[model samples]
Target: MIPEPDPALARSLADDLAAAGYTGARLRALWGVAADEAIGRGRALPARREAAATDSAVAILARLFFLGSPVRESEASAALTNVTIDGAERLGLVRMSSGSVTPSVMIRPQAYVDEHGAGEWWIASDIDESVRPGPLPEDHVLGVGGASLTLAGLQLPTSAARVLDLGSGCGIQSLRARRDSPDVTATDISEAALRFTRLNAQLNAVDGIRTLRGSLFDPVQGEVFDRIVSNPPFVITPRGADVPAYEYRDGGLTGDALVCHIVMGAGVHLVPGGIAQLLGNWEYVDGEDGLHRVRDWIAASPVPLDAWVIERDRMDPIAYAELWIRDGGTVPGTDEFETMLAAWLDDFEARGVREVGFGYILLRRRTEGSPALLRFERVEGAIGPNAALGMHLAESLRAHDRQARLSDAELAEAVLLVAGDVTEARHYLPGAEDPSVIELRQGGGFGRTLAVDPALAALVGASDGDLPVGRLIAAIAELLEVDPDALLSDLLPRVRGLLDDGFLTFAGGEASPSA
Candidate 1:
């Protein structure tokens, strides 16, 4: 059932939770580190046991909501004096029978630290597989999982007038986007998921978020916004009777058509100069590169866009099928598991699917007559746990926009400075003084590292916020007894890349501090 929560009771419950110090940090502290980690691995025994030992408000809420363990009605009433058991029932959060209360939905505290600051929100969603009585229903609303948190941190830090969150499941991205945007529109295909979004908004006391019911871009037709953020339903699933098509992940399209549709929709829905960021997966079929396929999709866009797409990880057809099959709560040795696996294999074989690529995508609508920047790369690694990358990305876009207008002669006159987080690493063979390899590594942003030749290394070493880049290049050429013009020609293109990547910043014209 799609819950229609009461705002009044939600407010009262929020106050009660605040009074009890119910939050992610407090819960993890209540149960030691091992117990917390074990909970994530689908075992709630430690947490249930630890929380059951106490009758404190935090414990009471945790046992009822997180662990879904039954709690005495009298104890719950005492813990939430403001919103007693009756009030909770009115809010559609719990059920009462035989002097005990059981949770209908899981209401957990999710802590977030982004460009704005650190804060917590109460999220209501369907109980996880670990706590559920059986396999989830088709339309299960998910909580703050890893993918949800990732797109949250990627939201731009700058303020916006309006933002659109497509496929806004549980409203996590919308909540995060609301930090910097005054107006937010969250859309979804499932009314159940939209109910969860409304429930979370009320729990967090966040206003100005309007809920709409529709598929991707359907609700916001003919509307333009300054920014759009989406953690869409991009997971790959087979459209077979044996395989479950969960609403939270699958988009009900054959192959990777759903992801392609979302990418193409950005062209019409976004205003000129507006940005749209989403997470998606692309297919690698026989003799076709997944990244190239994305480039083709961008080319087909009705509007011009500057795109920066990163593929973080890839999985073969068998591995991908097994991972998602396990996610559907089917154990490997079961008959149902064998049936689903066979269906997945049949689907992959029909499509000639070789691999699947998953990652982040950012697209900005471009103005007419302006050159659009298109970057497609693969970076397979780990980012900070909850690091806010929006600030770094904004700076990079600004740098690229500024440098695109400068010519070689103009750029030569610009002063350059190495970024503060940049460091140089040198490696030499045993018993050798001259280094065989030199690398420039960034300590922030995407954590990029680049190799450098001797002349480029000398130039970067000399960029200490003083002198023009051309002057430094000429000095390096003179030191190496090479033609200054040839050296300048060879290094200026690389310098442009360095500037765009945030390894170096222009210290001239309007970009300078003194200017």
Candidate 2:
């Protein structure tokens, strides 16, 4: 078991790291760019060689902690000026014997940019595959990975009364949430994971984070939060003695049941107007669509919720089995890999699961009346895992609420502006004066593209802040020789879609002329 965290030692370590210039950019400069990138791919030899060449405090510390390599006790003692080797050992950061100090945990600098601006935090978590090079123990705590950064980037940037970070592994989401909310509660089933959360909070000098030990929402029953962010242990795994369920990814549930449990329980713990953002997976059973299944989950919520779910990728059962089997450090040709693959396939076959869909889920408990938004879309594109999309999401939600309240006639009278990130592209045939296809492309926020007809494209092009929607359509109708009512009827619903997708926005007021 990991030792309980000590705040004084964490503070000292933080100061020593800061003084040593131990930052992501600085470390990347210490090693070449290729070596830094190689470390991310679990090949640390290049970085190890680079660290061996330098005797600086940062290099010595990196060798001991970041690379999980043994270091001479004298060098470690000299490197860690504030938190000495004894303090580090007591804090469960390292173990010392025979004039050598070996790392028990890794403290790496993580850099992030969000709506609150850019900053760096030192994240301390258990040693990863890069250092350990084997199948992880079931209780292994995870450091920052792709999924962690995804949920962290997806967290709403707006202020909140309180936030709950369910399944906070290395406390990355908790740290990110604390930037906006004054209070954050990070919960995990493993006590060791909670200790890391507490230690990381102290190391980063970020307060107002309370760590609890429990599975799912057991630690926060009957309590309501303004926001909830989670990258949960939603990985589907077979239930048997032969199969290993890593606590970091698998929630010990069958075939996306864990995601369902969290979705159903979220509505109960969210305050009215509260939002819950989480990454999840859902199984497509036999012929049932996965997105529709998620829609049903929202419909079955005790408290009606506004839901927006985007399925980013889908994998067949075979692909899914291989992906997770390899994630457990099993090579493709190995006997254990084949056994686990067979077990995973058998489980999927038993459940009639044909495919699994992975995506982002945003749920909002309604403040009053029934839910208004229920969008489940399969977005296809290469979106950056750590893109700062919270600002776009918040703006889109506000636009949705505004347009949802407006009647068609009222919306027609509202002045609108095409978003700055939106662009128009026209494709013409050879020797043709008129374009055959007109596409409106979004530079951000899902990077959506829409093909528009000439009338709609003309209306969009003419949507300056000076004129209201009704007038713009009228002018376009005059130029195109179409009936004004016919054009308005054709354009109103598309305008609403543009608003919801953030292609356009109200100039200032919901139904007022732009000033």
Q: What lDDT score is found at residue 117 in candidate 2?
A: 78
TM-score of each: 0.97, 0.97
Q: For candidate 2, what is the lDDT?
A: 0.89
Highest lDDT among the candidates is held by which one?
Answer: 2
The C-alpha stretches of model 2 lying farther than 4 A from their native spots are: 384-386, 509-515
Question: Whole-model Cα lDDT per candidate?
Answer: 0.86, 0.89
All candidates: CA RMSD (Å): 2.2, 2.4
- lDDT for 228 in candidate 2 is 95
Q: How many backbone clashes does candidate 1 have?
A: 0
**Candidate 2, position 135, lDDT:** 79
Q: Summarize candidate 2's per-residue lDDT along 376-466 as a digit string, tens digits.
A: 8999988755544787788788888888888999999999998898899999999999999999998888889999999888877777788
Cα misplacement distance, residue 108 of candidate 1 (Å):
1.6
Candidate 1 per-residue lDDT, tens place, 6-52, comes to: 88888899999999999999999898899999989988999888998
